[model samples]
Target: MAKRCVPVTVRWSDMDAFGHVNNVQVLRLLEEVRVHAFEDLRDHGGPSLLESGVVVARHEVEYLAPLVWRLAPVPTDIWITAVGGASFEVGYEIYDAVDGAAGGGGGGPAAGGERTVYVRAATTCVAYDLATGAARRLSATEREVLESWTDEPVPFRRRSR
Candidate 1:
């Protein structure tokens, strides 16, 4: 799997009265993961997606377990799910390494370790032309970069028929 694993720090403020990371804050964590991945891609022959203007068209998130605050960063796995002319889909899994050990950074699960998934999510992102303020088709370089990280769709538990 060509996924990107990012270690995201959980802030104390991210917790809610119930003593777990707030549901809304989970989205923020996902954003952090994406930002890290985008930066990495840029350094490795990929387009500077942030600078070029990518917008979130939609998001689907499913919470499986409550994520509690911890000293160690949470391991988040993200990958490209689909690539379209002007849009793309990204999938994510927020999880904990087995025995609370932070997984190896970069990609994939920890060596011979299981993961306790906290959330599953997918985001639809559209490439935008900042000057024109309109959606734009992905460039050849951008498409190649995205395809290199492409993986299976998010295994969402619930889906509409």
Candidate 2:
């Protein structure tokens, strides 16, 4: 299947007292990505993805650094890392839109030149029937949409990889 990409924005509320994005918001950020993945999968979800039983089976996030940066504007970029039987994983990298680097990309005094900070996140989610509590597979149309959602080698350290 192809990778899916979604853009996410950092809201002022998303930041923390330290003047950075809060830890929990990253999960929400990842979820926003997954929601868009389903959106992509379902040809840009209208009501089904939400109406359907979607649940987060597991979530893991690696905070490379604190959310202590300021930005005039934010961009959105998230991906559907993988989709399994009734389950899927999502990944994201929120950074400065201008420089296009992860976590400043260097360890020297010149490192701070990057416009954005890289924060990689991965989450495992599941689709279930609310009434029956059974796993549900995405419909054919949805699969096609999901397959169209992203490019290859989605920046995720997946279980298979």
Candidate 3:
């Protein structure tokens, strides 16, 4: 499946005293992209993962480079890394798009330009029954929708051997 490229604006407040995006704010960026992904899936005639009730079970983030405040929105690529009975993993890469490489329709970075990645991360999301307040198995429709967005896992630098 093709990765979804979402352009995320970095707010001035997201910057820390160190003059770069705060580590905590990076998670918020991932959340924003994930929410957009779910909405995009629903817009494309797929089941609404958000409406069905999903929660983040885990998040692994690697800070590769400091992201300074910029006027242009950052290009972020997000895709499904894994899917299981009740959970799925979403991988993300936040990077700088050289030239005019803005992805308007889920396409990745533009060709012929070097890009600098700021972060690589993944989130594990679990299906849940909000009515019962318990984890639930993934439905066929949900699984199908997720599988359609599947891609390779994030290549983290400090992954366990």
Candidate 4:
């Protein structure tokens, strides 16, 4: 699947005293991107990816570099990595959008510049029936919808190479 990228603004409050984005704020950034993804699917008149009784079961994040304030919005890429009976995994790659290099953080630094990764993360979300308060299997329609966003799996570990 093609990567879905959203531009995210960095608020003044998002910066820490150290003059960089706080570690926790990165999670908020991820949340913004995640919500945007689900809302896009929801707007298409399909099942609500978020409102239809879905809850985050796990969130794992890795901070790769410090993100300083920038006028341009940060570009975030999010996609589905895994789909299971009652849960699915959503992955995200967040990085500085500098020098018009949006979504370019995955690559090495430019010859005369630097493009840094702010975070690489994933969330496992479980589908639940609110009334029953239990996990519910994904329906065929839901699975199909989610599969549309599925992409190549992202490694959780940082490679030495």
Cα lDDT of model 1 by residue, 1-161, tens digit: 79988989999999999999999999999999999999899999888999999999999999999999987888899999999999999999999767665544547555787779999999999999998999999999999999999999999999866
Off by over 4 Å in 4: 101-115, 159-161
Q: What is the lDDT of residue 62 in candidate 1?
A: 96
Give the candidates in order of TM-score, highest first: 1, 3, 4, 2
Clashes of 3: 0
TM-score of 3: 0.89
What CA RMSD would you report for each candidate?
Answer: 3.2, 6.2, 3.4, 4.5
Residues 41-150, model 3: lDDT tens digits: 98998878888899999999999999887777888999999999999999999986665434435366557767788999999999999899999999888889889889
Candidate 4: residue 52 Cα off by (Å): 0.5
Which has the greatest TM-score? 1
lDDT of each: 0.92, 0.60, 0.88, 0.81
User: Per-residue error at 41 for model 2, in Å?
Assistant: 4.7
Which prediction has more favorable TM-score, 1 or 4? 1
